[model samples]
Target: MTAGETLRGLLELTRPVNVIAASVLTGIGAFVAGGVTSHPVEVVAAVVATGLAVGAGNAINDYFDREIDRINQPQRAIPRGAVSPRGALLFSAALFAGAIGFALVLPRLALAIAGINLLALVAYTELFKGLPGLGNALVAYLVGSTFLFGAAAVGEIGPAAVLFLLAGVATLTREIIKDVEDLEGDREEGLRTLPIAIGERPALWVATALLVAAVLASPLPYVLEEFGAIYLAAVLPANAIMLYAAYESFSDPTAGQSRLKYGMFLAAVAFVLGRAVEVVGAA
Candidate 1:
């Protein structure tokens, strides 16, 4: 491939927007956990490692799900001939190795957590993706790692873990809803996504229920007197927005646009609420 073509393929593999979102979550977790250490170098290292891992996961996912993407996401790098499957596989391996080395520079607890996170993504692409409910659960766990990574950077775990858990649950619901939205594409590609295996209405109901629970439970930290009232005020409305989007999503199950909007809104909620917790706790 030409240099520009190779770069474009790499960029797609990295999914830069997703990496930034993950890094922001990491920063928020560190701040909220009161673990904001002076280890800027360590934090940078963690961010690079985490980014590489996420990129690698995306590349590997694309490699494994090539057939599915051919139907579901035709313009993806692999399907568009921007990157070959074998090339992506090699890229993933190199990135994974780099992440492992970077993780080793951190504390043992952080290292272990990073390793587990990488392993989870590997499992996700290799085996878990085909499983029914387990796929969504693993995706949540993978996303939750950003919080753990942040907490580990300061060699501590705190309220941020709870936030991580809440975000994970919410994202899991999004994943299920996405599955519902992609049911036809997945079915055409002979994939076994949740909505394909279970009925559409049932999957939508489960997703809506989980979203409601996640949004409702988001206020617990403030309610328990762990966070200031500012956090409650800031996050509650954000959570409400998230719930509203999810609710709207349920009414239009067939719309990919709605599902994408719901996903973006869910991410916004996380960003807003996480920053709110950080600000309130900092003050």
Candidate 2:
């Protein structure tokens, strides 16, 4: 392959959009904790570290899942021969190193979270991916931990606790749906994912139930006085979209998971807006 193609493949392996979204989530966590202004450097560090870690995780996952992707996603970088397995591994390692470097400069709590997350990312594909719900839960925790990591960076994790739970549960729901979408390849590979352990319909039902619970509890941030009316208003629509997405998953898992991601992004935006309103009101 040409140099440009190889570069593109390497970048694709990192899943840049996910990296950016995770970084934004970390930034929101710091903002919600009221540390963005007081702890600007730490917040930046946390955000960058989160992005790097997510990129690293994605790359490593692609490397480990190369075989699976050949069946489920022939267009993927590794499967398409855009990037070699060894190259992906080395690139992921470099990203992990960068994440660790940034994380080491943060507080003890943040450092601890980062350390655990990095280890989990490394172990996830090989050690946990075959388990039924355990893999999904681990991925959910990793996603949710970005918020806690940011809050910890500023020495206050309480404010972001609700966000962590909300995001984590929502992510878990999506992960399950994704498993259903990947059922064919997972079955062929003998991977015992949630959908494989149970029936596809049952797995989707579990996902639906989880999404319902998360939607119902989404208003807690406002009710608990952590956010303003704007948060409630914004989150209402986000919750609706997520619920609709969950309903759609039973018919078309691909569309459902994609829409669910959009809803999650909207919810994240609502979080930033709510925090902004509170900050403005205080000012």
Candidate 3:
């Protein structure tokens, strides 16, 4: 492979897309936590740290999952021999160390959260990953807590709590769907994932219920006056997309699960935009 190809493979092993999304989440959290005037330097550090942490987590997950990928995702970097397990392990270690180091220069809270999140990610891959709803809930809580972590960095833990709840519920819904999509591979790998534990049909039912609950709560920010019409408008379509992704997964879970990730991304965008609108209106 060319240098560029090698670079791309390494990046893919880190799941750059998810890292980017997480970086954005950190930025939004910083914004909501302190407005524009609070902790600009710290916020930047936090964002970079979050991206690194996510990359590290992804790399480690790939390292641990290489054998599984050989069967379920042969084209992945490790499975395809584009990245060695040792290389991935070292890379993950480096990223995690860098993330913690960066956060350490910020607030104590940022440092603490980064350290804890790093440990949790590692544990999730090795220990908690096989559990059914427990693993799903853990991942969802971690995703949602990114916002709180950001808020904590700025020394403000306000409305982001609600955002945490909303994001967690929605993320859990998507995670359950993903579990369904990966049921076959997980079963072969001896994983006791939610879909495998409760069967696909029941798992889908649970996932769909969570998705519906999130959709119903999507309008809460507007109702609570935490956001304005712009937020409401953007959230409407986001909720629609989430609902469709949830129900459609019942028929073709793999495809629906893929789309649901994008839907969740859209929902995140709407939240950011709504907050932006609130800021602009206030100005």
Error of 2 at 114 (Å): 0.7
lDDT of 1: 0.73
TM-score of each predicted structure versus truth: 0.83, 0.88, 0.85
Pairs that collide, model 3: none
Q: What are the per-model numbers of colliding residue pairs?
A: 0, 0, 0
Report the C-alpha lDDT of model 3 over 1-283, residue by residue, as the tens digit: 5667667778997888999988888788777654546587788788889999999999999999888789889999888877778888998999998898778877777677787888889999788887779889989988988887777777776656666777888889889988888888778878898889889989989888877777787787788888778878887887788788888889888778777777777777777887787777877
* lDDT winner, 1 or 3: 3
What would the C-alpha RMSD of candidate 3 be, to one decimal place? 2.8
Candidate 2 lDDT by residue in tens digits, 1-283: 8889999999999899999988988988898788999999999999999999999999999999899789889999999988999999999999999999999889999999999999999999999978999999999999888888889999987548877877898899999999999999879878899999989999989988987887888888788888888989988998898999999999999999999988988887888888888889889
lDDT by candidate, in order shown: 0.73, 0.90, 0.82
What are the per-residue Cα lDDT tens digits for candidate 1 across 1-283? 6879977987898788987878776765566555555677667777778888888887788888899788768988888888888998999999899888777778787788888888887778788888877899888877876877877876766666667766777677778878877788778868888888887778767777876776677767666677666666666665665566566667665453355445434544554465566666667
Once fitted onto the true fold, the runs of candidate 3 whose alpha carbons sit more than 4 angstroms away are: 1-9, 70-84
lDDT of prediction 2: 0.90
Better of 1 and 3 by TM-score: 3
- State candidate 1's TM-score: 0.83
Name model 1 segments beyond 4 Å from true.
Answer: 67-75, 79-81, 254-283
lDDT of 3: 0.82
